[model samples]
Target: MALSWALASGAQSVTSGHRTLFVTLSIVVTLVTLGITLWSRHSTHTTGQFYTGGREFFAMQNGLALSGDFMSAASVLGITGSMSLYGFDGFLYAIGFLVGWVVFLLLIAEPMRNTGRFTLADTLSLRLRERPIRTAAAVANLTTVIFYLLAQMVGAGALVAVLLGSSGGGTKDVVILILGALMIVYVVLGGMKGITWVAITKTVLLLVVAAIATVLLLDQFGWNLSHLLGTAASKSPQGKAFLSPGLEYGKTVASRVDFVSQAMALGFGLAGLPHCLMRVYTVPTARTARKSVGWAIGMMGGFYLMTLVLGFGAAALVGPATIKASDPTGNTALILLAQAVGGRPGSLGSTVMLGIFACVAFISILAVVASLTLAASSSLAHDLYAAVIRKGKATELEELWAARYASIGIGAVAVLLSLLAQKMNVAFLVSLAIAMAGSSLVPTMLFALFWRRFTTKGAVWATYGGLIVSVTLVLFSPVVSGSPDAMFPGVDFQWFPLGNPGIVSIPLGFLFGWIGTLLSDERPDPAKFAEQEVRALTGAGAY
Candidate 1:
């Protein structure tokens, strides 16, 4: 289909044969994915089936799905593009992302599965009497999902504009609307079952594409990664930038510290993300959750290592000029590199590369948006509406309907926000989301899971304090403030460097929670504490 479109649009004859082939491949992948998703829709019924795969998924299946959830456009395309452009600085992001999974595996996965019925809020409010705590957690969850959806929307617009050969603002808006609608369908109709299967399929395809691209590049360069790296180092003033720490390239000491600290913040922040944590509940057992996380960490780690090769390969083969020309948006490094490696339009290799990447991009966005919708819906339906508003009196069917409605509302709101924040960089927006998750929610979650002394008041204060500090810092950060050159020229004030405040905000979360607990007279409930500990450690109550 992509090929036909490319041919019909004159892309085949006008551009290199490689370009046409690429488009053709992309169309085929999209059609296949759409067909599968549609065929699977009839099987998805009830909220359990939609949200947690009926809690029947095996460890391996859930693990792949988890990888799918983790491998957003930010990981697949963004990381590749970053490495292609920034060299080692880009790989730093990948390392942080992958290593963060270790923290998730060790501390979050099994416990989250054991304690939460369906969402983060369920686990959080299990031992607490405070409606305020649940509401605050929901707020944090919503914020993270919205920011994440915005980044994915931006990425979708960029992908559509590149693939369709349209570069107008209207084109981006249309793409965002279409992507948003697709996500709603995936979540509302297909539910968790649909999301999980789609995610697994996308992960397999991503790994295959990475393998093929890596092998081809290595073969082209006599299978020498070191030689390729040396060439890239020789060509760019950012010599050996791919091998050393990102701080080495910082223009000043402050910039260096900011860069390294941001990387560290990002690494730790992954453990706190709502979408990532929600997946833990999909598996049947806490043990299964732990194993799934282990698998995800390994799989993701391998993928990140592959990205280093792709990035250096792009630097070596595509040249900076072409990358700059084709990737003005800075998100098309992999696409441009594929074009360079596959040769001009009409080539078999070029066609395949283009098709694979296009498919990967589409699937990446689909899986993530679906997860975001699910996260938002869970918070609203399970946490806010069912648990609090109705005091658990709502029937299962009512909860399901509420979730579907929430999905639509969340999708609409996200689309609107994406439109409003259209000018923001995708990476920066993603970082902000991670920072928010890390700051506001991670401390409370960790304390609730491991510390028997953690109180409801403490959790509430920690969540709000983290939210306030992180949001304020991010809003006034370089990305939003237009540092060095304000959003409106001449404005100056560097509230935070590197645009992500997780490093600062996460510690503040801990401090606030501690202080709040100390000031409150309330003590941990003995009965609730024992119940939660048993559930978290023994996989007794996950169902």
Candidate 2:
């Protein structure tokens, strides 16, 4: 279908046979994914099945799905692109992201699984006043989801245009619409079961593709790591500096602070993401959730290590000038790398290899968008629509209907925002999302789970205060203005010095929670604390 579309779509600039082959492969993969999603819809009969996969997935299966949920197109394209363009500075992002999983495994996984029923609100509401805490948590969840989903969709539109050989016209807009519709279908029809299977399948394919590409790249220098590094350094415009840090970021004190801020967000923020936290509920027991995190850490850490191969390989072979020419954001580095490593353009073998990588990238985008849609929809339905609107009396059927409609609504909003965000850097947006999650969700979660004196007022203050500060900082930061990479480059009203505000916003989150609790006269309930501690520790009352 992609091949047929390519032939008829009048994408004349992309006349190469290799380009056509990639389009065909991308279409084939997408169709198969759609088929599987439709098939999985049959299993989603109840709200429980739709929301949590009936809590039946084994630890390994859930682990792979978690990997899929975590590894977005931004990670594959943006990280590689950054590495290709900036060298060691880009790899820092990968390290930060990988270390986040360690934090998840050590402190968050078991307790989150044992305590939460569905969303982050479930865990928070266990020991706090239900209405205010759930409402606050829901708002925080939606904010993170909207920002993250918009980044993914924008990246998807740009990537689809590049892959389809049509960078101009309305091709990108059309592709965004179709992708949004497909994501809605995945959530409304297939639910958690379908999304989980898609994630699991995509994660394996992603890992396999990365490993193969890495080996082929290593073979270019006869498996000599030193030789590969030397060649890449020579090829880079920065020479030896490219092999070191400070190429992309860290030029000044402010920039260095920004780098640390971004690393802090990536390391602490990922564990608080609603989609990842929701995955904990898919497994039946806390032990399974713990084991799932172990699998995820192994897989994610290994995959990130391969970014060195793809990023440096691209710089070594294709050069940054060519990568930047295709997309100023360097998002097209990996695609060009595939073409360079796969023999040459117009050759059958090269075309096949390029197509495989294209499919890997497209499938990755699909899996992540589907997971985000599900997370957003579930939060709306379970936390707001059921808990708030219906006062915890909403029936299963009503909640399911709400979820389906919410998916469509959320997908539509994401598509619209993505179109506006096309000119922005995908990696920056992704990191910003992580930073916001870290500031808003992580502090509240830690306090609610660990602090015996945490109050409902504290939860609301922390969640809302962190969200407002993070968003405000981003709006006024260099990322939104002043710099060439800023979202609104034409207008320069930048106030914040650093692009990332995690350094300030994270501590503010914890501070707000503490201050709100102390200022308020609301006393801590011993019975509630005892109940939550037992459940969070022993998995006694977990669904």
Provide the TM-score for each candidate, comma-separated: 0.92, 0.95
- Residues 3-26 of candidate 1: C-alpha lDDT, one tens digit per residue: 001111212222444435445765
Off by over 4 Å in 1: 1-31, 240-243, 246-249, 328-330, 482-490
RMSD of candidate 2 to true structure, Å: 3.7
Error of 2 at 7 (Å): 22
Model 1 quality (TM-score): 0.92
